[model samples]
Target: METNLNNQISEEWTVSEDAIGQRIDQYLSHKFPEQSRATIQQWIKQGYVKIDGNDTKSKFLLKGFEKIHVELVLQDRTEHLPQEMPLDICYEDEHLLILNKPVGLVVHPGSGNPDNTLLNGLLAYSSEQKKLVRAGIVHRLDKDTSGLMVVAKDGETQQRLIDLLKEHDIKREYVAIVRGQLSHTGHVDQPIGRHPTQRVRMAVHHKGKPAITHYQPLRVFKHFSLMKLNLETGRTHQIRVHMHHLGHPLVGDPLYGNPNRIAADVVSELKDLVRAFPRQALHARQLEFIHPITQQPISIKIGLPEDMEQLLEDIEYYDDLDTFDDQMDVEYVE
Candidate 1:
């Protein structure tokens, strides 16, 4: 039997005689087959599950005819109202969706942004998503960074995709223009965490989560370099912080970049143009992973956004005026 109370969905079941001596977690797993065993065990640990109205552990042995109860606390979905907005979907199927998120579009609602976010648009696109947590959003890109993102259509697939991300099965690649002349492939293996004093920014700290960013220069300009990057771990602001830590912050990065990094020899107009660029010159260009439900591989790639294309064109035009020299190429050493 099931019932709803306040914001919780309560369910109860009587253990059958055939199930006697089974672990509580095992029994509950049979009852809620859609949920993972870890999730069921977490519920037991959190005191959401009870046996005959008494809190119990997941290891408790279930006796015949014992009443098992589960209370699932629902997330606050009412706070987000659906709003119609255009979505740049790259691929879509019954199980998931891949979309190109534009710059300045907030992924979800937060302190100041309560609506008009991608989550609201997703709900408007498919009312079914309102039932899934965060509208099935498993990953995110910064508001100022444009890129590809995958959104699950169901809870089971959502959990699977999350597990894949944690296991580093998903591959995400990006292209960026950074303020330096990189002549070789390099990588930054660092720890990233919230800044000690700056609450809004992330920093490379010793006590932070492990993060690795591998980068190769696609084109080295006179002062700036266009690079292709891959992330081995996705910590918040991982790429931005790692690049900044390398003294090569992404061009036009508002938070971690220093405008003074521009070389003085650069022409005045080009310097102003680089400084006036609005957002970070980073774009997620490729995404590859195995479909969680279909067991097939999926790969999607997108061209550079218009702004980035134009920025690269401008840099090329200015760079042609300077004498060309072959930069020595070096490999990144751990």
Candidate 2:
């Protein structure tokens, strides 16, 4: 482990993008062509590089045309710390990538899941710079929600994707088995923020930012309903919060829903399928966004998991299926 005092590297560049606003780490990645991500992460951790002298969020918006300054510091070792992990890569190209994130895989490390997160998997997968953490994580899916996600390989493309998400230009939709038989179609518009008494849970609070979830009920069983939900604003726990606020928390949600709420009739019919459906019954079913480099629309669809599929089969077997059609069009509008 050798170290060096080449701890300061300085550069200045002007933002050329109108959409590339606040995500400074990503912006500078494009601006500083020769500098690698390993150097950027080191700079970020050392408080050397900043946007307008203020440290900014990785997901923060970028306002283009700002004259930015950067300072970089080199890590002690530039060698790759490699760990072997398998990934189910869906699509891959020079600028963009897509992966099928499995359930129980934490997207990034936190309190309980400090090691072996999706980020760690990405680190092992990255054949690029050795020390950068923000290699290509453009967005994230909750640990329990299994499905497809897109990642950016470089800084310019990453900023464009982030900007698209912020502007609601991108589209993301989810499917989940939640409690109760909800209306055929409805939208929940509520502001979600951290709970006052319990920090872990989210609630509809006046101080929280605006959150909207449009749901179309697809099927109904004795008690539970399967619905497709579309997000308007990307916020933490937005779908779950909005659903719970509507008195229909997702089935098997340990954190927010009534765990024992599965009605006897529903449970009796789902005896075999119940064990398979363990976690919160949510899956990111579809994703659509513009290709930043190609400027063409890309849409990908993932079918439901075996558990969800089995659960629905049982629902149909138990009674005359009063399920609503799943053939409706969903589009995002302001």
Each candidate's TM vs. the true structure? 0.83, 0.74
lDDT of 1 by residue, 1-334 (tens): 3646544668887888999899999888767644557778988999999899999998999779998888887554335899999999999999899999999999999988889999999999997687677888999999889989999887778889999999999999999989878767979999999999999999999999999999997878778888889998999988899999998999999889976568888888889889889999999989999999899999999989989998888898886426555554622111
For every model shown, the clashing-pair count is: 0, 5
lDDT of 2 by residue, 1-334 (tens): 1224564556666667865654666665655543555555556666766667676554557777666566655442323234567888888888778888888898766798767777667767875423333556767888888888887766567667877888887788898878777746889889999999999888899999999889987666556678888988988888888888888998778777866665666545464455346788888888898898898788888888776676666665763346544454422111
On lDDT, the candidate that comes out on top is 1
Q: Residue 62 in model 2: shift from native, Å?
A: 21
Sequence-dependent TM-score of model 2: 0.74
Model 2 alpha-carbon drift over 4 Å, by segment: 1-30, 33-82, 129-133, 264-276, 319-334
| CA lDDT, candidate 2, residue 318 | 66
Best by TM-score: 1
